[model samples]
Target: MRVYVAKSGDSLLKISETHKIDLNKLLIVNPHISSPMMNITGSKVYFPSSPISDTLQTPISECPLPSPSDLLSSWIPLTSLEQMADTDYDVLIVGSGAGGGSVLRRLAEQWLNSGKKVGMIEAGSLLLPTHVRNIPTVNDTRFSQYFHTVSKWTGKYLPDFPGARQLFALGGRTLFWGMSAPRMDDSEFFDWPMPLKEMKYYYNIAEKIMRVSTAYMEGSSIQEILLKRLHENGFPEARDVPTPADLEVTKYGQIHSDVFWSSISALAYALNRMPFDLAVNARAVEVIVEQNEVVGIRVMSPNKRAYVLKAKTIVLSGSTFETPRLLLHSGIKGRAIGHYLTNHSLLLATAKVSRQQFPEVLGTLSIFIPQTKKHLYQIQMGGPGGEDQWYLWYSQYEEKALLDELLIGISAFGKVESRFENYITLDPNKQDKYGVPKINVNFSYSKQDTEIIHQMAAALNQVSSAMQAPLIVPNNRQAICLMPPGGDYHEVGTCRMGDDPHTSVTNRYGQVHGVAGLYVADNSVFPSMGAANPTLTTVALSIRTADYIVNQLK
Candidate 1:
């Protein structure tokens, strides 16, 4: 194969795939390649005839980084373009969400240090501007209105507030995440297809990189009383768990923040300064495959211009919902593509409390209850009483102090079995402006879900009574704002990873069974949705993918 040079918006995975060449072989021919740190649009690279699949099957002992000379040689003017040259890179990463973001951070530090050209591709606009937190309220319209909806390339609309917000902006969904960074229990990780030990280590590494912190802040009187009551009610260990941000201050005395709103944050925090080709406003249209192996992808820019990219290896970091949609569009029909979908439900209960009782509650705190083996419950943090009305349900408590400052919010996540009824399909009759099918998500809760939430609420009320914060559990219909199928926005398990190729889309190592050099490292690979936030786990799996890619490259 001839050497190829990447031009404007070119990706390595798209190129090698175009010629049916192995990604490792292509990189072998051109050993000195730039990392995502550089945007080497005019850099030259070699293409080899042998398939990387054969050579890369054997695991390498260590991951190597590119040399300084290689980095210099691969440096192309950020503005330069030379599209038609043949060059090979060790790996190519797609998407810049939790999965892609974590891998790129690791790869840039390790493999890229060995002087290997690594190409990272992103197909959404950079919604976040530099120096975001300094801009006042976190609820600023820039983040709430524009950044939220603009990232979506689905070309279809969902319910306004919560649904339409899952856009494809620069940091992906990380920008608006509640920053809840809970660790997955051993049972959660052990149940996965891959070994649990390595996964736990990876989770730790990812948490460090993301600067995840634990929850902190003074607990409200209600929280204190509730815990005491739970103890009295035979559940003493159940208490509120802090968020990553809260924990940083509480546990480590650190006030670290997150780096998810921008791709730049992911690279910059790692202290990396390489030029990488990060194309914004570009949407991946299809996955191009030949001989049953993924080669590259077709992308459409905001201008409606279509471009084809070839790469030796392709990793899909799109979220759970979109990942399956992409695979199905590319014709990789697996039963697991859009099955076993799970998202935590938030059930809001209202009550009236005295204003004097509202002084203590600070941040989002939660009390977890592991009910039975499969069923679990959580009573989230809140204030006074009627405050739940704007968010959950209205209140009519009489006391002046009680009725005025009453606000509460709580959510419970119940693990549900994968059912055929809960699925995703392209609305054949509808299409976005870009002509992609409008995604129609059909999701509802089982009776078990309802039972758990009601039970959780009863427990919460008992606890609140100890603190003088009584709650009125409304009918399910009235609590619509708090508990919905996709309330917490934690969606997972669309394209699961497993040992059985016949039943799974990706293997334990995240590699697509039939497709060489193609892997998915996102919530899409989750087989069973554990009763916790999915971001940290997604980060861990992505890091694992990075390690796997590094091994194969070596």
Candidate 2:
């Protein structure tokens, strides 16, 4: 359990050579250190299995060494419910996904030196320490396989919501989310309950914390040439996709090992600000309500034992599906608690382009044709990838023996209307091991939704043709493929936010109607899934909600 505090001018090479530890073993144990040449100053390098003998020579350093505790410790500590039950929390977050994580980040940032108590409970145990794509070993193929293995396919029980899946880990689905962190168009929020001014203010904060940048593809030749083609040929709205990545370098003994952003990243920021009680494998089965206010949450342990954790406020970020289920199970009075389920109508088209179309240094492509007044869908085109449209940077692929074509994929997300008919309700006949009833979904695309899908298909064609990439269809498949509902993994609006008690579960501030201290902050709170990825907007709303909660406390 011995740890080394990395000092200036010290790296894995120097430490390995000086300490007589195998260099390969050092990398194996310290996954946090991405490269041997990285400046690991202010980092705690562990020697979990290495043995240090008394006969070994004393280590010499170019710079003064830091105390063990002075260096950065890269571990999230968990507190058991047995102890957590004794102390009350100011805010108890139900799930640790993007929504819950953002709420925790804002609160911890604001209350860094304060004594405000915060607690978070996650149903699943710690999975990946960061985003799956951030890991060096994970590529496109392994990414899909690994994600499928970890996440719970909740849609299996619901025939209508067959594509629905839930990853109940500490970081939730963010571990596998594609990092398209675009802000919803200002026009999209024209009719929202909250003011556009507040939404813009929170979006800036969310993007700042997430390190959202458009420079990821700035220097890439492939992106440059293809995007130019799109702009020249009718699709002038195309631009570089906004990616959530920490492009910062380490400096002055500070470490920046985590490059890709995830909820785990948010949790890390929160911990750096202040310690919060985090209990994993703690499934929230019911919310305890007193009169019309939320009192606490009844959480079930792995062994089926239930514990009630007291909190002045509770934010449900369990997700679009799980949040509604919990509300219905608790019998919380909300006419729209589980109604108005909505997801984007997804359309996909893939084509092959000549590899020689661009310069030899073929970097990856990520172009975004955003949702506009004329078009209700946004198109994200990326590739020169392999067989499908996997990002070439993250996946390994074999060259096409007969052809010199590069694969390009365009995904169009068409905005679907949030209808009251498409909703989720608990199945009284089914109860899980924790004694909570399962949820059933009644979802179908309306005529307007189907028309949007057609429009998305035409748009995808125009863009692909603009890039001079001929669309290719798989055997017996249409050129424009319409993915099933919920296939996008961007389902939303079950616990939508609005001012009406009968039409919305939570108000614009995210508080549940008629219920004080109960809030919804996940994808569930989005009134509509406006053809943009919900992660970025969800984080923005969660931050705004956190600010509201802070004001209430004050």
Scored by Cα lDDT, where does model 1 land? Answer: 0.61
lDDT of candidate 1 at residue 459, scale 0 to 100: 62
Deviation in angstroms for 121 in model 2? Answer: 0.2
For all predicted structures, in order, the TM-scores are: 0.71, 0.85
Quick one: best TM-score, which candidate? 2
lDDT of 2: 0.87
Lowest-lDDT window of 10 residues in candidate 1?
A: 73-82
For all candidates in order, the CA lDDT equals 0.61, 0.87
Report the lDDT tens digits of candidate 1 across residue range 288-368: 889987777776767677766667778888787778877877787677677666666566655445556434442223454
Per-residue alpha-carbon lDDT of candidate 2 for residues 395-416, written as tens digits (9 for 90 to 100)? 2343423336888878999888
Which segments of model 2 are wrong by more than 4 Å?
1-74, 395-403
TM-score result, candidate 2 = 0.85
